[model samples]
Target: MSKELRSNFHEQLTEIRDGIAQMGAGVTELVPRATQILLDGDLEAAEYVILGDNEYDAKAVELEERCFSVIALQAPVASDLRSLVSAIKIIADIERSADLCVNICKAARRIYGHDLDPSLRGVIQKMGNQARVLFKESTEAYLNLDGPRAAALHDMDSYLDDLQRQFIQVIFESHAAGTIDLQVAVQLAVVARFYERIGDHAVNVGDRVRYIVDGWVPEHPYAESDNDPPEIVDGVIVPAGQS
Candidate 1:
């Protein structure tokens, strides 16, 4: 590749990376905003979040397309190819996390006028804050190329899982105490699930970051093995395979 061509390729990759980061930042804000809408019963905020998802979805699609274009046109190899593949996966995770926030807002609207007990409210707040933190940390890991921090996101996500369990228990107790009816309890349970899923998606982003940095994917014990098929490098297939 010519020096000018290589420079252009890197610039495109950087733009895609920045786009993904912007999406992550948007999701981080959406989580807290949706949670507040749930806690405060703000229908206007709920509607805003619900409608805003359309724009997020559109941007995600555009970003994914850009990643694919770079792969097709530039024909990146080695770490560069890995980064593009991981980026596509990361973009999906971030997009889904954003959709989960919209789900939270929809749940809030469903349970409008319902009041949550203090115990339930407290757990919800903690879960929302934790979800936001998880995404923020994962984005930072991607930005800084911090593999260890990206790996730590899995452990960090365990707390969010615990919070989801605690919130469920509080929901049952609140129902038993007549603090909330069955309908509200069910909606709140779904809301808790939305928050938990957001954390899971954030962890997924971390996994993709690890892949981008070092070809480490959780499902694969080893990135490559002797039994594996011929490798593709620099747009050519090695060891007798087609280009």
Candidate 2:
């Protein structure tokens, strides 16, 4: 490749990376707001989160198009190609995560008037905190290319799953006691699922981050690739759960 062409491709690549990073940051900010809105029954805040999703969606679409354009125009191979591929996958995960937040906001709308059982509310709030930490750490891992740190997220995710189930059990307890209406219980269940889904998406991004930094896509069928991308640093550097 000519010098000018290589420079231009690098610039485009940086822009794409920055775009994904910004998207990650956007979601990181929104997660806490979504959780707070849920806890406080803030209908106005819920509406804000719901409407903000469109901006993130537009960003996702633009990033995906940029990735495809880079592939077509630069024919980036090896690490350059791998970087773009990982960006595409990461963007998808981030977008879904943003949707999950929007889903939480939607759930907020459904249950705003219902009084939550105190025990169930506490557990659900903890789950929200866990998920927000995961989201923040996952984003940091992506921006820093910390492979091992990315892998560490799965443990916390397992814990998040357990917390989600506990929240549901509490809801069941409330329902059995005739404290919460059936419709309200179901709505809270859906809210728990949304937060749990956010954790899943964070773990998905962690896997992608490891792939980007170490070029070692895990033994998952969906991640199997034909290209012989260059290997960097022998082992994965998974990011652990952050405070």
Candidate 3:
């Protein structure tokens, strides 16, 4: 590639990176906003979060197109190609995290008049804050190419998972004690899962960041190449017609 062409390519890559960071920042902001809407029964804030998801969806589609264009036009090899591919995956994670926030808001709207006990409220707050922190750190790791910090997000997600468990237990306790009705408890339980799923998405973003930095593939059964035939063992079922 000519020097001028290389320079333009790098510039395009920078713009894509900046766009991802901007999206990540926006999604992180919604976490706390949704949590507050739930805790305070703020109908206005719930509407804002729900409406904001459309913009994020549009942004994600645009970012994905840009990444695809860069790959087609520049044919980036090795790390450049990996980075662009990872950016595409990271965009999906960020967008889904935003959708989870929207779900939380929708849950808030569903239980609009129900008041949460202090214990349930506290746990929800902690999960929201933790999810925000995870996304922020993952975005920074991507921007900085800090693989170690990106890898650490998985461990950090455990706290959010624990919070979800605790929150569910509280919901059950509150329902038993007649503090909250069963319908409200059910909505709150789903809301807890949404927060936990956001943390999962954040960890996914971090995994993509690690891939960009070092070509690391997370270990999973489906990570193998499609052309590779499945191995058959005693009583083990391989893919159909591939044994």
| Selected candidate, larger TM-score, 1 vs 3 | 3
For model 1, the superposed segments whose C-alpha errors exceed 4 Å read 220-243
Q: Candidate 2: where are CA atoms >4 Å away?
A: 221-243
Q: Is candidate 1 or candidate 2 better by TM-score?
A: 1
Which tens-of-lDDT digit does each residue in 1-243 have in candidate 3? 999999999999999999999999998888898888888999998887787789999999999999999999999999999999989988988887887787777678778888888999999899999999998999899889899999999899998999999999999999999999877877777778788778888888888888888889888522321122222223353442232
Overall lDDT per candidate, in order of appearance: 0.84, 0.81, 0.84
**Which model scores highest in TM-score?**
3
RMSD of 2: 10.2
Model 3, residue 148: distance off in Å is 0.7
The per-prediction CA RMSD against the true structure, in angstroms, equals: 11.7, 10.2, 9.0
Task: Report the C-alpha displacement of residue 194, candidate 2, in angstroms.
Answer: 0.8
Mind giving the per-residue lDDT tens digits that candidate 2 earns over 1-243? 999999999999888888898898888878888888888889998888887878988999999999999999889898888899989988988887888787777667767788877897798779888998888889989888898889999998999999999999999999999988877777777778777878888888888888878788667654412211111111322221110
TM-score, candidate number 1? 0.89
Candidate 3 RMSD computed on C-alpha atoms after optimal superposition onto the true structure: 9.0
TM for every model, in the order presented, reads 0.89, 0.88, 0.90
